[model samples]
Target: MSCAEESGRIMVGQEAPDFEADAFVKGGFKKIKLSDYRGKWVVLCFYPGDFTFV
Candidate 1:
């Protein structure tokens, strides 16, 4: 099985596919795309729904 099939996740050093999502920036929400920051470093943060309050 490939890395994706084995863990259902991208392995370290693997490239991430381009994606778009709503992001909060500068005290406002905006739509952003992964490709927009191409060639620059980016960090992604995830939180469990149960641990966060809407």
Candidate 2:
């Protein structure tokens, strides 16, 4: 199967589509975007809630 079909709408080695949304940062909510951290290492975490082990 193609990468898109196997991985929903995203594929490896491809740039993540840009997006803007409110995110919690340093005890405050602020607008954030994927492009905001260009050229830097980013670790994205998606979970049901905090303190849950992977």
Candidate 3:
């Protein structure tokens, strides 16, 4: 089966849908986009805010 058929959504070698959001970085907020990091290694981490039990 093709990658999309197996995944039911995105697939290998497929471009991610575009999106924009405000991010807190370097002690400030900035607008960012997924397309901004094309051709670069990106690590996305999701976690609860500090002072809260996991």
Candidate 4:
């Protein structure tokens, strides 16, 4: 990376690294490939384990 880019932390607007990873959906296991949402914004979220403080 160039000095300017390195000096500053990667910004949100930049494209995320290409990747394919697992995820939990509707209490079921599933694979969530990032490429599926190419050119679109994706908001990932998660909840804590049961009994944990909200």
lDDT of 3 by residue, 1-54 (tens): 112223346667976655677788999988877668988977665578978775
lDDT of 4: 0.62
Candidates in order have lDDT scores of: 0.70, 0.70, 0.67, 0.62
- Candidate 4 stretches with Cα past 4 Å from truth are 1-9, 45-54
State every prediction's TM-score relative to the real structure.
Answer: 0.59, 0.63, 0.56, 0.48
- Name the candidate, 3 or 4, with the larger lDDT value: 3
List, residue by residue over 4-42, the lDDT tens digit for candidate 4: 122335468775555566666899988777667977878
RMSD (Cα, Å) of candidate 2?
7.0
Per-residue accuracy of model 1 over 7-31 as CA lDDT, tens digit each = 3467788877667777679999988
User: By TM-score, who's the top model here?
Assistant: 2
At residue 1, what lDDT does model 3 achieve?
A: 12
Ten-residue stretch with the least lDDT total in model 1: 1-10
Q: Count the backbone clashes (under 3 Å) in each candidate.
A: 0, 0, 0, 0
Better of 1 and 4 by TM-score: 1
